[model samples]
Target: MNSFLTSGLIHAAFWVVVGLTFGGAVLAVFPRKIVYNVLGLIVCLSGVAGLFLYLGSFFLALMQLLIYVGAICVAIVFAIMLSPPLHLEVPKRRMGKVVLSAGASGVFFVAIAAVIWKTVWHPAAERGADWSIVTIGHLLLTRYDLVFELISLVLLVAIIGAILTTGFSRRLSS
Candidate 1:
């Protein structure tokens, strides 16, 4: 009885997380205000992190929350706050442009979906049973040093760019 109840609860939680993810995605894209958009992105990323947890990849979930929800979303919010046009409304777009963009996106989506469906995904024949966090970290630092350094550089540049823009705006205003 207890096992059944636990399973049922887990299923319910999974649906809730999925709903939050899609709802947040809709909220992120549909909002006209920058603040709302940022908030929605945070919510969506949080939902994605929760979904990752459900998939049994605890490390990935933690990274998703840390890198995407915590770091990137906070940085985006900071950038929006630093900008002077917080109160300015977004300009309306023409219907033709909107339709063209939607059509292009649809085509891209279809092509990607076709590729995904056509691809034959096979797991590696030799599987290592060791899944320790420490090992993962060591591998990242040793084998993927260049990729890690690149990611860090990109993040640093983004932060610097945000700071420069804010400083420039402040100087102009003064």
Candidate 2:
């Protein structure tokens, strides 16, 4: 009975995360307000991190929270706060442009769906059984250290650039 209850809870949690992911994606794209879009992105990233946890990848989940939610989202929020607000009216969408974009998106979606449906997604033949956090950390620090450090450096530069740009804009306005 306990096991059944636990399984049921896990199943429900998975669906909830999935819903959050999809809902957030829609919210992010469809909203005209920049703040709402950022909030939606945060929610979506959080759902992705939760999904990583469900996949038994604690490191991935933690990294997702740290890198995307913690750093990137905070940076974006800072940018929004520092930048001047635009009171420009929303432009009316052109029907022809909208139709073209929609058709392109539909074609891309169909192509992707077909690829996914046709793919034989078997497990790797030599899949390592020992995928513990310790092993992963060791490998990351040893083999992928440069790539990891570069990513961090890039993020740092981006954040710095956003701050500088906003500061310069404020100065120009003043």
Candidate 3:
């Protein structure tokens, strides 16, 4: 057997990470406590960062840590703090709704899997092999200029909106 994938250490690490990610999802979405859910989301996102590292995208993995773990998760934490207690029990889902949701997600997953498996992925006919950060930046500015600009604009708008909303709410309440 190949030692890398089948080794005891590797297997242990893989299973642990999988368990953490799955468990985190359960924690984040389930339970009445919003705090626990947020904690779970953080754990889940960290696991995703680990997965990104394993997938040979160290840059993406670091970015995942910096952005998702740092910014989005922090924002969620702040939101939760602004809200009520986490100990409240949310209403249980109806069986039919649960089944429908499961069915919908399952179908979507299967459809995506089928499309991925059936499709043939080919690089451009005469693609240049440039995977450097500089190359990516260049591509972003030239080929994906609009998308790049749009994302920055969106983030800026979101920040301004968040500030405006919070300021307005405080004034109105006062």
Candidate 4:
């Protein structure tokens, strides 16, 4: 009975996290306010971290929280703060553009669904028991070094761009 209850609780929690993730994504995209978008992104990232925790990857969960939610979101918020307040009226979206975007999205969704339907997913024959932080760190530094460095570079460039843009906007406003 206890095991069944625990399983039921875990299942419910998983769905809740999924719901949070989807809701946050919608909130992030649909809102006109940048602040609300950032808040939604934070919520979405937090939900992803929770999903990672449920997957038994504590290290991944921590990294998701620390890097994405902690660093990126804070940086975005800072960028918004440094920029001048946007008081310009938003232009109305054209119906043609909306239809085009919707059609493109539909095509992409169909393609992805077809791929998923055709793919045969097989579980690993032998699962590795070494999910330790040290193993992951070593793998990241050794095997995935280039990818890791590229990600770092991208983040650095983004931060620099944000600062430069803010500076230029301030100068222009002055």
On lDDT, the leading prediction is 2
Runs of candidate 3 exceeding 4 Å displacement:
1-6, 82-164
Cα error, residue 147 of model 4, in Å, equals 15
Worst 10 residues of 3 by lDDT: 83-92
lDDT of 2 by residue, 5-36 (tens): 99999999999999999998888889999899
Q: Tell me the lDDT of model 1 at 106.
A: 100
Per-prediction backbone clash count? 0, 0, 0, 0
TM-score of each candidate structure, all chains considered together: 0.61, 0.60, 0.53, 0.56
Root-mean-square deviation per candidate:
10.5, 11.1, 12.1, 10.9
Off by over 4 Å in 2: 86-134, 141-161
Candidate numbers sorted by lDDT from highest down:
2, 4, 1, 3
Q: Give the whole-model CA lDDT for all candidates, comma-separated.
A: 0.84, 0.87, 0.77, 0.86
Which is better, 1 or 2, measured by lDDT? 2
Off by over 4 Å in 4: 86-134, 138-174
lDDT for model 1, on a 0 to 1 scale? 0.84
For candidate 3, lDDT tens digit of each residue in 1-174?
568656877668777888888999999998898789889999998888878766667777776786788778877776655543346444455899899999999999999999999998878555767778667757876999999778767766776667676665555554
